[model samples]
Target: MRLTGPVLLVASLTLGLGCSAAQAAESGSSSPTPSTTVTIPPDTTDSGGLSPEEVQRQVARAEILRQQILATSDDMAAAMTKVEEAAKKANAALQAYSEASTEGRDAREKAKTQADIADALQERLDQARSELREWAVSAYTQGGPLAEQLGYLDALSKEASEASNPLQDLNYLTDNRIRSVDDIRQVAVAQKLASMNAEAELGKAEAAEAKAKKAKLKAQGFVQQQQSALDELRTAHAEHVTEAGPLAGLLLGTGDADAIAASERLTDALAASNVSIKDLRLTPCTDASGVFPNGQIPPSNLCPMVGSSDEFLVPDAAAAFNAMSKAYAKDSGQLLCVTDGYRSYAEQVAVKAARGPWAATPGTSEHGLGRAVDLCGGVQDYSAPAHLWLVQNAALFGWFHPDWAAQGGRLPEPWHWEYAG
Candidate 1:
């Protein structure tokens, strides 16, 4: 029987015989041959019914493919670095936009307050001038200052006849007329200053609004650039997968012992780079239309995990998580349990409503970006063995507990983890 793919890896490594056991079995042996009883095959012999020259060529081809895979891995690493830089730029732009927007709002409120103060001052100046004009008209009608003063006093006494304190009202009216006439020029100057200040504040508010709009546009441009970089990276990955897939198939299907050995080496190298044969068969996520602003990514745009929980994440993150989960299972004798992954926009809205301040706002969560997960099965407790193990090793798989989820954080959550890539 011809073994293939991962089973070949297991059979060779688990038995510690490489492909020799399979070779021996194919030779029509009745029972398993002991190492002591084994005889060396001829140097000219090649297993899988191939000539020695053909086997050598297959082995050479496999080595070439392995080298190509390493080159592709380097390309991917470079691409990932670019993606990270783009993300940083995008974040900086967003922060600028947020600060500009806040300043714009504050400036607008300041302008409104200043305008209201200016309007009140203008009204006060008008009222003072109107009273001064009436006083002047009374002085002209009465024919002299002394006569006008006596006339005003008589008018006031008539108005205060029903007052609770007629003497006090008369005294206040006499003091107010002198102060109003003296303060008229000061009120006019104050209103002019206020109007000028209001205009300045209005100009500042408009400038702030323009700055906010520019910041928003810059932030949007950065986001689009980041998305384009990601798309390019995905395209490069798909191309590499296409090239590596057939090479792997050609090497493994040949069943030549030397070729199989070389194929196994290629597999090991792929694993070392956090890649798998299955990756070569996966559908690339290329369509990112309408799946931005966090969350709202379609299922077809993400990679689904193996568990029944229906958890999913972005392609690179999902692959890392899968590799990490497998390692955890091997070391701990149990699969890593995930409580949450890749939240849709609608799901995020529901989560926000249900959890209130404990949950991130909709469209702003890292989970919405398909790079975070909430894990359980002893991983939720900071003191648990599983959590301890993760602390020691998760970063090796590109998963990390963010500082916000660390102990003593503002809202510590030991279960939350995110993919760095």
Candidate 2:
């Protein structure tokens, strides 16, 4: 009855339906609806039971992804725009050619225009093909079937494969995998469809290119060149339909690869763990020790980290931190001294009262998120070996020292590090 979360989405990936059909199916069925369709719901909809802020955040994220994709593909995207221009020119040329073939009115001038447009189109087709081919080859060679890169035939093949089976090489599915599968499958499908359209366009362009060459040689049937150009333009329009959708926001490359991988891992970990916004809201900042006024702290979603810190952290973040700690000890033969971990609102208030503004504000404290930790021993010193090692290695595990907490930072606390998970 609740048409929220990943159900309708996964159904869409698995079934492939229009947004309206999917919604209709979701609203109609009480049983698990294996509906087809993944319409992007409004960013903020009371129907989905999500707050406006959550919708805004989702939209913001999509916007950021779109920007990143376009930023990386600026040159290629610009080249692709020429396809549209070429399509327009081809239409014009075809009209001129048609007029030339008409009963007789100095047809030479119109024929010349058609030939000229064909020449321009051939040049553009060559450039677009070359650019796309390069990017596709790079993605295929580097990522194999898993690469998300969009380019030429390689991008096509990968999109098709990924669209169908995103979990191909992975061993098992996490909660995130199950829930995210549909949302991502839709993206992959959109990409796959786009690639198919592009393939068709490329084929038409190649054919037109050949015809254009012949026209140049004989300069005879300008009328034939006009027909070929018209056909290519039609294909370009079809390709544009796919292009105007998902590919605009998706980028497949290694530049942000680590961040992407970490995000997936974190999502899985969050799903598998017993963590929820509600549970976090119920947790106290610290065990009551009467160290602060009223001993009451804002509730937080903090879970205990494994192996070392008894300090609580948000579930996945704690896991990442623990993993980092293990690797750190193996590399350096020492355990980090954790003098402090998750702090309640009350605890933050107490610490700040004692330390003044030198401490982060209570609600603003990273410790409140259960992702911040305070180290003791030599690790707290900016020049200490432990701190130096952490700076070099922690990012590998999705942990980082905040710029504000680093040496020469506004606060300059070398003892602090936060899990980015």
Candidate 3:
């Protein structure tokens, strides 16, 4: 039925609805409505078209991606911190190496300086040893105690070289070695003094030897000179004795035995008259020319007492008297008179009794030896010009007057001399 009117239509729709329901019953209730139109707007939330469970799963996945990004940033920050720490460590090592290098260089320089000082000390020691050796050798050559002492010093030097401690070595050199050096100096000074003294002694010895030699030579020369003088005197004496032989016999009355006998018999008359006579009396009365006699009484014969005969004096006495007389005459035009010559032993006894012991005994008298003479001036005054002339020139005839105190029994007689020859 075609439902046209409203009531009619209602009745038809009911019928149709019943048929559609039978047909909808035949299809599944889960099928999509084809005649119904369902419309939806665009989704504003992040779930888009998903269900609640799907929306929840998408939120969880997004949360996981955010956690991964955070973890990566943390790793990068850790790497940066590690790089800063490494840089700091490298800087600290460089600073430590620089300090170590500087200290090592200083140590090396110090060691070098100490070595140089040690070397200098060694050289000084060596030089000192050499000098000591030389000095020791010289002392040994000289031969004495100094040589022995120097040997000891050399040994000490060698011992000092082997010492380990530097300070100990220095102490040995200063106190012991230097002291030894001082000792050597003192010895040298002492030796010099001794040498000077020895030289002085040697000089004195040489001078003494020279002086002794000179004295010996002078004494020898004097002896030779005296020998010549003695020879000349002896020759002159011999010549005088030979020339007076004849005169001596005439004076002694040897040529007239009768006259001599008569004279002997007139002894008392001669003695009473105090006639002066030599031991050998002259025959008759005579002067130099034997032609005159003086009447005046003669003095006592002192010559006979002395034991000397005029004959003993003979020519020597005559020659000497004549020579003196000639010199006196030539110089002063005056004559020298001879008053006495020699005497006998009896005469000396008489003189001794009269003049005391100062006179010589008979034989000991110089007059007995015929070596004496007594002279007189022809005029008065024994100090006359002729007497003075005789005194000045008598020594030329080898004559000398004894001193006044030595004249036996006579007073000082300036005109007397003994022939020294």
The top-ranked prediction according to TM-score is 1
Give all candidates' CA lDDT scores.
0.67, 0.48, 0.42
Show how many residue pairs clash in every candidate, following the order shown.
0, 6, 15
Instruction: State the local distance difference test value for candidate 2.
Output: 0.48
lDDT of 1: 0.67
lDDT of 3 by residue, 160-214 (tens): 6563554554466447647667655655555455445445544544554454444
- The deviation in Å at residue 386 for candidate 2 is 0.7
lDDT at 193 for candidate 2? 52
Candidate no. 1 TM-score: 0.49
- In model 1, the runs with Cα more than 4 Å from the true position are 1-59, 144-178, 221-225, 272-421
Candidates 2 and 3 compared by TM-score, better number: 2
Give me the runs in candidate 3 sitting further than 4 Å from their true place.
1-314, 378-383, 404-411
Top-lDDT candidate index: 1
TM-score computed on alpha carbons, candidate 3: 0.25
